[model samples]
Target: MLQINDLTFDAWGRRFFDHASVSVPPGAKVGLVGRNGVGKSTLFKLILGELPAGDGEIGYPKQARLASVDQEHPATPVPLLDTVLAADVERDRLLAALETAEPEQMGEIYARLSEIGADRAPSRAAEILSGLGFRQDDLARPMAEFSGGWRMRVALAAALFAEPDILLLDEPTNYLDLEGALWLESRLKKYPHTAVVISHDREILNNSCDHILHLIDGKLTLYPGGYDAFERQREEKAKVQEATRAKVEAQRAHLQSFVDRFRAKASKATQAQSRLKMLARLPPVSAVAIEHTTPFVLPSPDRPLAPPLVRLEGVTTGYDGVPILKGMNLRLDLDDRIGLLGVNGAGKSTFAKLVAGALPAMTGHLARSARLKVGWFHQHQIEALDPDDTPLDIIRREMPEASEAARRSRLAQYGLGAAKVETRVENLSGGERARLLLNLVAAEAPHLLILDEPTNHLDIDSRRALLDALNDYQGAVILITHDRSLMELVADRLWLAADGTIKPFEGDMDDYARFVVERAKQAGKAPTQIRAAEPDPPPKPAPARAKVPTGPARRRAEAAEAALARASQALADIDRALTDPGVFAENPAKAADLGRRREAAQAALEAAELEWLEAVEAYEAMKG
Candidate 1:
């Protein structure tokens, strides 16, 4: 579906891609991976024509549509669902033309619309938005009402709804919560078109993609299967190369010894010269470079704390006397590893703050051991650092009693080398700042650590390093992150933030994934029922067709219901406007217009009812 031939790109005094060639087959989900600053995004820019490559060609089908979510969707007055529906440019164009097209042109447009299933666009867009963490009410909310992060999700939803031939997503889960991430993973696994995602979330790369594309040293290598398969194949290939290089080196050394011994004598001059030619003809084998990932330093607590480090009984907390989390009863022990899961704005961070003593409970009892020490690391901590301050300066303030050497040593332990010690916070990479803050927060070895969305800025390897450090640290941990792999590896138990309270979630990540997808499916059904003002009775669960219900049949049923609701609402709106006496008495043209619209809407409503009945029958057949 896409091809790059002999691509060479150079910028800022360095080459990003050197003779890199790769072909992505149609419908392949490819995960693009590399270390930080390896030009993965630069390659995307080249493909998008934002950057001109110094050499070679990037090609795809001429008519193919390419879509990417490079930035947040524009904040406009348009409703969320309308914004997403408009992403299907072909559908929008056909609909616009339908309003004025001549009679002869109507047949072709209608046929094309049917072929593309334009009638189902609303529910499809809603499903995408719901899967990305938007609520049923959010569909009608203006785009301008959402924050930047939610707007980013809207851009993603639009791209997914458009179903472009080539979909490019870069770190899509960065703005997502755990539930949204899980839903996206499920969605991408079923995406029909070609998708190339740049992500550091190991689980997404391993589960959502069928292929892995590794970019290293200005070269691209495509591997079959997921990330684990890529790692194994790369290791085997390296072993073979290293073995071959060793054999060639031994052969060269023997030839050189023969040349050295015989070069000084005429008897063997001809043979020595022949050996020199052989040595020169040997293929050069570059030695494999050992890659090193900097380790995170999280010191173990000096002393262990007693069990029940913290306990909350019916704890209610919020800002300005408005409760965000209510009736929360929970306990943390000295060695518990708890993974906190929720959607954004579900009060996970607020819970963390309450435990960290940054917020007081509005009501109910909170108890903690008087000697308990807690280390809190949150996403905002990195942003809170002063731009002009250096690591050395920060460490000096943090470790005032320590000598200059001790302060520098502490910074090094946090992965900041001497060169970075004096570097300003603004100059430091995100991973560096994260590393410094993470280590600094835990430097004193507190008995408990509350880390919230800690891996957002860290790359895959660095995330693994932090995971290792967390596992090694002898303290109770409360972890919140969108990275599923990190959560599974680090947390022993799961807690869910839902319905204005925290409670123990009774399942593993796989079960939680199913719940997320199923919840989105339910959310997709809610908006139509709300607008119709007559909710459908809930269908009884069919044990034999549990899996099939969440697939296409449920979506089609929801889409049909949405179409019906829209038709009914349009008819109702026309009738309501016609009820105004001024329209008939003061403006005859407006009255005629409303009458014509009402007729069309009535016909549309009848057609929608029949479609909804057929969809329901089809879905019921699937249940059977």
Candidate 2:
């Protein structure tokens, strides 16, 4: 469906693609994978004829329709559903023609209608919209009312509705929730037309693609299977190259040593000269330098503590009397793992800032324990570092009390060796700066870690390392990440921040995903479907009669039950703090009192929770 031969593209006087060739056959599902800024989007543009190829030819099959969903949406005031329907101009025209036909021309119109209908088939716009997670009611809602992520979904719907012979999707899963992403994957899997998608989501590529086109250093290499296959092949090739380089270097060293030893001796002079000449004729083996991979090292607190690290009571936060968060009462206990989830511009960052003490709440009181320490990693954390300082310098400044050997060891742990450690922070790439910032934070060993979009601009390897570190971290964590895979790996619970409130989901990642989808459907924001129920197991048999309880056993059981009740009451208090509107309002004094009360309640709740857990464990052990 699409073909490129000797294609070369240049931007800013730098060659991004040089004599690269690739092909997407009819009905093929191909994934374009590469490092950032490697011209994946440029290649798509060339195939779509949106950009001129510098030195090679790009061709599309004649009569083939093409569509693409780039990073940004085209500005339009029309509703999202209307925009998708407009893609099929022919369908609209045919409908219009059918509606206006007269009885007198029915005979003549019928023949023309048949021909036109056969050639220009009407599109199933409604079905396409539903399949892409748009509800029937949302069809008339203004596009401006939706967020950027939803707008991207609308654009995707339009592209799919067009029924193009070949579709080019670039970073389609960038801002999607798990449900939306899975919907797109299912659609692409069943799509009859050819497709080329560029995505950083390994799961998406593995599930939806059949072929892999890897772009590296202006060259395109094709792997027959999916992403997993491509990765395996790449690893094997790297191993082969390393072995070959090592063998060639060993032979060259051996020949050089023989020449040096025998060059001045007459008996072996002729042979030595022959060996020297042969060595000189041997082609040099150029091996790319392999750097040690950095492991993400999250800071470990010196001592783990009890609950009530931070408390928010009846707090409302926003700008200039406008509120984004209203009546939010929350408590952060030590060792709580929470994932903050919401669409873009949904106050996720604002909440993070409030917790970090970077911004004061408009009305609510923020309570933090005196001993609590916070380590915040912002979305644009690189900007927080001093550009003129070297990586080692930043580490030293951040951790002054540490020994020289310790500082160097920490730098090395973050993949900053002796050479790169000396390079100015300003000269580092985005990924490098991210690593350095993480290294600096890890040195602090704070008790509370707050990360905002930590996965942004990071490669797969870096992301994996960061996730691994989070898994091992013992401190309380609040992670604001767009990467679903990262969330699944690191988060033990989810905090859904939406519509001026925060809702907690005390379950696994899958349950949280289901909740989001169901909520969206309930709000008339997404398509709804009935799910099948699983079969239930048979009831258990009654237990045998128990022996009479002793006095100590009865007292212990009574105490445990009382503790459980107290913990339940504390939970209610925390909930009230979260739902208090005074904190979110414009009155600071009123908010402060409420905040204090909320903190006290949270402390009570934490103590209750601990006691309850202990009681439950005891109860379970006794029953066992």
Candidate 3:
């Protein structure tokens, strides 16, 4: 349990918290939500003792193991799985002591290891990694081998493996794909220990949190139940406060008017003085802190958008001829709203960059309209800005031909206040920086907009604003986001960026959401269990024949084939049980159990086939 008593924290000459008190009971899954720059992250740091309290008392169990996602890893040639498993410091300490322990202490160390389940650390680490969308081969892969996004996953896996008494998760969904995020939400729901998560994802907040802690205007409010309940309760509280404020204001006004009218008259001088005293003694009505509600306004393209703004025919794109997306056939017609979906490292970002023309296509033909204008909001695009430059400077530099009014007008729509327009970009909060970057793209007035993880740093309200703007805009949009609500609301069509290709998803958002969850579950299952789900075939080639695996790669192909054969045999045995009426009659319960197990087994087989197909495709492509 954690108790925060009469907390008062001040920074930048402004009070962030004033005599705020809150308690987190044991095993409470609390979602700490607030607008960006509200000091939610700062509170986490204070709880972790990374920062000294400004003026408050914070108490928690002394033995509590505090854990949060590590943003950085030391430069070491350690396997990803090994690095994660090593987070269990106690396990490592016990193992180290076992090597040189005294005779009497040897039994004690062994008993401690058994108590902590240290021997199963590797398996436990693997399960966490699998849930986070790591493949079997990734377990042995060095941390240096993965991309930045994958390394972030490694960091997340390490945090989970630590298995702390209190887990502090800040924007945990940012590094995850839809599948990984869904898996993490499920994992947190089952987590026995306490967790306080800071996320802009409403789905995660509503599903995983048992309580909601809102930090509003120098005060803290803890409400029981999930985010939805918190919203309802907060609204009710606001309404009650509004009525009380109105009554107080009316009484204060009457008293002041009486004093003003009679204070100068000698006949009622004493009474007027009394009225003045009463007016002074009346407490001011507490005003609700007005939220900064800034709607994102995107300017329409200057000219009419031609149909099919961009087309890629049999496109193979990659860096240095190493293909990430191959034989991609895609077209973006006017007003096409396509939501890009896939696991991390599945080339969603790569495809976006290719379409944005940031990368040159390695093969196949590409066509663009003569008047094509492209607007892009790539992940972390805010970092691309000059840190020393302000929003005003950035807008002016990007649109030099525009008048001053135009530049300021564009910035204002993004909620960049007059004072903040000239503040150093480096000094801006993550959400503020996000808005500036968005403004940069919006000002371009492009017919096609490609946004990759645009809602990463945005709060729920900002996301809603962006979605509303996008929905009303008459332009083609290729949006890549893990925010399901944003995707479901803005995208009319869905595109799956996986299996070395980009293709239309023939399902609704709900179906895609279910697929993401199912895929995550399959990630945790045995290989023999997921073979029934079909892996999308790579785009068709002109010759209509795929290259076959050969040479050293053939060994891997053969091994996969053998393993799949074994999985198939396991399925056959289950089928035999399904057909055995004599066994059912003898033990009906046993038959029902067998039937259920067979279904899971079939799902596992489907997943295995998908993996096998991807392997074969990659190997064949390498040979070619």
Candidate 4:
């Protein structure tokens, strides 16, 4: 569906893409992955024609729609649902035409609208928004009511709702919670048309995409299958390349030896000349380049803390007198690795603050071991860094008692090299800044760490490095991140922030994912009711009359409708089981099994719904 041929682009005294060529097959979901500052976004800009390539071309079918969420949706008075529905230009055009089109044009217009499923646009838009973390009531609220992060999700929702021929998403999970990310992953897997996503989240790349597009050294290589498959294939290819290079080097040496020995003898002069030509004709092989990422340095506490380093009893805390999290009773041991799960605004951050000692309980007892020390790293810290401040300046302040040499050495240990130490924070890459803060926060060897959305800036390799550091560190952890792979690998226990309280989540990530998907479906189930809040559009004149549906078409429609109803009921039952806290708390294994069943039921319902839509359309066509 898309092709890039010998594409060369240059900017800022560097070549971004040099003779890079690749073809993306139709209907393929491809993950575009590379290291930071490696021009992934630049390539997107080139594809979108936002940046001019120095040579070659990016080609796709003419008139094919391409959509991307380049930035947050503008803050406007338009309701979120209408803002998303307006993304479908063709549907909007047809709807507008209904008011002024000649009576004779009405039939064709109505047919086209039916063909494009225009009647379902509002609900479809609502479904996308819900998957991206919008509440049921949020759909009817004005866009201006949302924060920038929420607006960013709205932009993503609009792109997905538009269902362009080619969809481009850049780090879509960055703005999302784990719930939203899981939903998006499921949604992208079923996207009908082609999609190219730029993501560092390994789980999304492995689960959502069919192909991995690697951009490295100004070249593009498309590997069939997911991120894990790409790594294996690349490793094999590198091994083969190294073996071939060795073989070629041996042949070259032999040819050169023959030429050197015989070039001095007249009898073998002619043969030597032939060997010389052969030696010169031999192809030179370049050694395979290995990619390396600086490992994160997270110091473990020098001494182990006693069990139950932190204990809370009926803890209630929030801004001012208003409580955001209530009746929070939890214990954190020195060795506990707690995965914090919740949608945004579900009191995850507030709980983190309580644990970090940044916020005190308003009405309940909270206890921590006398010698307990805590290190907290959060997403806001990166944003809160002074742009004009240099790493050197920050390090100097952080280590006022240490020698200058020792401070510089510490920054270097944090992956900030000599060249970057004096550079302003604004000039540093997001990964660099993240690495600096992550290391600095843990440098004192605290007994407990509270990390909130810690992997937002790190690439896949860096995230892996962070995971390695976390695994090796001997400290309690309360981790909150959208990166599922890291969370699954690092956390041995789970805590959920929900219903205005913090409680133990007995099930694993799989169960939680199912619960999230089902909850999103429930949130968007009444899209028509939500859309009713909008001002009604002008009345449309009816199209030409048609014959009634035949028996076969009617029968098919009725059967499909019945199947859809059955599937929906089955899924609803599963959703109830997944949502009940008691199911998980009582029998964890049974809860996990129910999660798998829920997934199957969800797929069945979607299939039945699609079949019903097709059957209804057929019935409508027969009537016309």
Kindly give the number of clashing pairs for every candidate: 0, 8, 15, 0
lDDT of 1 by residue, 346-454 (tens): 8999999999999999999999989999999998988889999999999999988999998988887787888899999999988888888888889888999999988
Q: Per-residue lDDT tens digits of candidate 2, residues 88-186?
A: 666556556776778776666567657645333223454455445555566676778777667777788788877788999987765554446655666
Distance from true location, Cα of 317 in model 4, Å: 0.5
Q: Over all chains combined, what TM-score does candidate 2 have?
A: 0.64
Q: TM-scores, in order shown?
A: 0.84, 0.64, 0.78, 0.84
Model 3, 58-154: lDDT tens digits are 8999999888874756546897777887898989888889899999999999999999988777766766877788876766678888877778788
Q: Rank the candidates by TM-score, best first.
A: 1, 4, 3, 2
Superior by TM-score: candidate 1 or candidate 3: 1
lDDT of 1 at 543: 49
C-alpha lDDT values of all predictions: 0.88, 0.72, 0.80, 0.88
What's the residue-level lDDT of 219 in candidate 2? 89
The runs of at least 3 residues in candidate 1 whose Cα sits more than 4 Å from the true structure, single-residue gaps closed, are 530-624
Quickly count the clashes in candidate 4: 0
Give the per-residue lDDT digits (tens) of candidate 4, residues 97-164.
99999999999999999999998787788778777877677878999999999999999998988889
Worst 10 residues of 3 by lDDT: 543-552
